[model samples]
Target: MFDNFKKNSERYRDYEVIAKFIRLAIPARWRPIGYLEHLVRSRTGGRIPKGPFAGMRYIHTAFGSAYVPKLLGIYERELNPFIEQACALNCPLIVDVGAAEGYYAIGMALRNPDARVIAFEMEQKGRAALKEMAELNNVTSRVEIRARCKRPDLAQILATSDRALILCDAEGDEETLLDPETIPMLAHTHLLVEVHEFVSAGIAERVMKRFAATHKIRRIWQEDRHRSDLPFATLGTTLLPRFYLDWSVSEWRPERMSWLWMEPRTVNAPAA
Candidate 1:
């Protein structure tokens, strides 16, 4: 009976009533369920599906595109372990660039309530949604949401930090953020940045070389191989396109870096 319930729950349409009940019972605290609902709705456009969170309406917008529950699930799963390890290391500051809806930022903050998280979202709608989600998760106190992704002022803020974790997903502007000068501002920071194929033409190699000269680089998450010629598809079909590269300052060359790759979690997998 319980197995049947579990199976049925994973079926999107079959869980509509239950999702509605959860939404009504805990409006703000239902992000996981709400995210599932959003994912199901977006994947099928309100049609029935064979996955969880079946009947909820998925908002259609740029920001909404990043809210796919399956993708978020993958991110959370892949990120949590690294975050736990980082938290254990006594890292205090975390900067999240391209923090759509605050998922990563909120999750990091929730994980380490004492840590200060500065989250950056370039889109107004995304920033607003991030604020709402942060409030929903009751992590507003720990997260600082900003409307800009790149700012000299922000770089200055980071310059004062010696121990920090920086996550950058600034779409195509990643090269701009990897400036050697900026590296000093983030000297003591560990970085997790998403490298876009197009924007990173030769930039990825350049950044890597420069970072190697000054830090220890570890690849924490890599997306499946992506082809630029592929057509855009639905969230379910398109998948998250960026790769998460982890970096730390080198011990031998405290000024040089080394890097490795971490694979991304499979999308649309069973919840843990």
Candidate 2:
């Protein structure tokens, strides 16, 4: 019964994804109703209310983007607790790979006033917004925004720091980039890598084995947090397309992501 219900819920969400695309394909002015909701929600900025990122400001002009759910604190329940923990620990350096719009990077910076954030974003639009967000939060001085990141980039950055945290969401590229054998600097950094089983087969297992020798590894799966339950959500907007749009694509949304959190086994041990 539960399996059937879960399947139905996914089907409904997929349907909504399709409907959102169709609705957005029509020019914004023509939408008969809820156009105001679309405009207002897609506006340029917001402040995170809770968790490690509370009070952090982010620019939101990219349209039809799904991060609205994240801003509402309804996305990624699995990571929230760890985020808060990271905040309290306040590692001296944070390496945010794929730092889209500086969410994790800037948030951690705010939580740790003494920590410096090294954010890497390859996409032009996302990089622009991330820089803007860092500046708006008055954290640009501490945020080193880079256009790209590779294993060499990470090594260079880690060489200068004592202890660091790596927050990675590099899609499937992690399989190639995160090999500890190739990048020995990883042994010094804690990690929160978003595994992409959908994009690469057997990735979760391979990645785990790679780190098992040096770190205590924990796997966290995505949790379903219904958007309607968010503190800011209202009953009337429950199924509205205005709130569903993300990144100019109302059709595309990420599938369930499995995360791997790795902590070094000892202060002196190399990252496996």
Q: Residue 58 deviation, candidate 2, in Å?
A: 2.3
Output the worst ten-in-a-row residue range by lDDT, candidate 2.
243-252
Judged by whole-model lDDT over C-alpha atoms, candidate 1 comes out at 0.51
Tens-digit lDDT track for model 1 on 1-272?
13332233234333345446756778633334343345444546632222222222223322633233323243223344555566554456788888887656766676676778899888788888788767766777888888776658457656655566776767657678756565465544566665665544665566666667556666543322112212224453344322100000001111112222222221122223
Q: Give per-residue CA lDDT, model 2, range 1-272, as digits (tens).
A: 13333554466576666657868787754442234334434542466565557677756543224555545444465788778766665678899998878778887888888998999888888888888988889998999989878888888888877778899988888888887787786875689998988799899899999999988899997655443443433444455554343322221344656799888775443234
lDDT of each: 0.51, 0.70
- What's the number of clashes in each of the models? 13, 8
State in Å the error of residue 96, model 1.
0.7
Off by over 4 Å in 1: 1-66, 70-72, 76-80, 220-272
Q: Residue 221 of model 2: what lDDT?
A: 74
